[model samples]
Target: MDANEDLSPRVMDANEDLSPRVGMEFDTLKDAWEFWLKFGRQMGFDARKHYINKNMNDEKITSKGFVCAKQGIRGPEKENMIRTRNQDDTRTNCPVKLYVSLVREIGKFKVIDFIEEHNHTLHLSETIYMMRSQRKISKVHARLIELASSSRIKPKATHKLMSREACGRTNLGFVELDQYNYLRTKQQKNLIYGQAICLLGYFQEQLTTNPSFQYAVQLDNVK
Candidate 1:
């Protein structure tokens, strides 16, 4: 009946639900936080704990907020320190956020506010897993890394194998550098353990040769 009404574009609230929305309820604060984290991962950003408000009477959680990891800039006092150190501060004061409050009647947490706008560039989907909070060495990945190292396979080769098994690098959830770091840490642990074992063996041999052989180990301040 009306040309303007007929020409109006269809609505797109689907994507809004894809992210967090106001009045969204969760059974627990953890659920809300995890949901927000999932939303951040999907949106190519990282999230951080923002604030928590508790009821003064019962000391129960009244509200909670999760914000973009890059939400705040370095303060003025830190400006000289940062410049003196010749290091860059990554914070941009991005406003992207999710906040929820406890609903007494429903006994759930409801999202009171949601902001999707970000002042900084979001991470690319392909390399999003490389984010510090996202990258982790799982048990399976650790076993594979150990097996590969034991078999004398290179770190890069092991990473490729993991990518192939997961069908893509994104699915693998860690970059090649992570694999190298993990190997380095494992090697350090092995070296320390080997040193302790060698010392123990030497002590055992001394005791066998002379039952009264006495030795004392003195540790430095670091220990």
Candidate 2:
């Protein structure tokens, strides 16, 4: 398949109705963020961090919260125009939030609470793909890709391996074959550049030691 081709959406099975649950634990803050991002996409909404609580002494994050972008306001200008005749002016006020916090005992972050509600329409699957977070690869996924690339595995195979590994958990939705291909191509370019540098150094050494050395350059004229 072409790396850019839109693959089929991995929908949940009809029999499986696993909803986002409170107290879901993750190994690290990054893992927590990745899970919630996927959860938001699966639920047809966008996720963003509202705030992060930190420890004063160590300056480490102790808790983090996320909120839907659509939860904030629904076109205040439109609302103001509609209420022009009335004396009172009111705007959209949505209340939806999810909080996750670190548990010192377990050494993992857990969802403390989740307010599952939305005032706006859910985003389409195609539109969700355009979301920045959905398209960006997470740190864990990047590491996996690097490992796979070092083993000389193809991009498609690497993606398949990642998908298989993500089974029964929040899917690694951000890691796409196109990304893997791009990374591989970048690595190839770096290797070529390094080889060229070595060759240049060798030529420079020969030119300095040898008195009788000639180098020729050619260029094509184009209008």
Residue by residue across 70-137, what tens digits does model 2's lDDT show? 55553767667767867432223446677889898888888899888776677686567655456656
Q: Give TM-scores for every candidate, taking all chains together and pairing residue i with residue i.
A: 0.63, 0.46
**Can you write out model 1's per-residue Cα lDDT over 88-115, one digit (the tens) per residue?**
6667899988889999988999988988
- Count of backbone clashes, every candidate in sequence: 0, 0
Measured by TM-score, the strongest candidate is: 1
| Cα lDDT over the full model 1 | 0.80
**CA RMSD per model (angstroms):** 12.1, 13.1
Instruction: Report lDDT (CA) for all predictions.
Output: 0.80, 0.68
lDDT of candidate 2 vs native? Answer: 0.68
Which residue runs of candidate 2 sit more than 4 Å off their true CA positions?
1-18, 73-93, 137-223
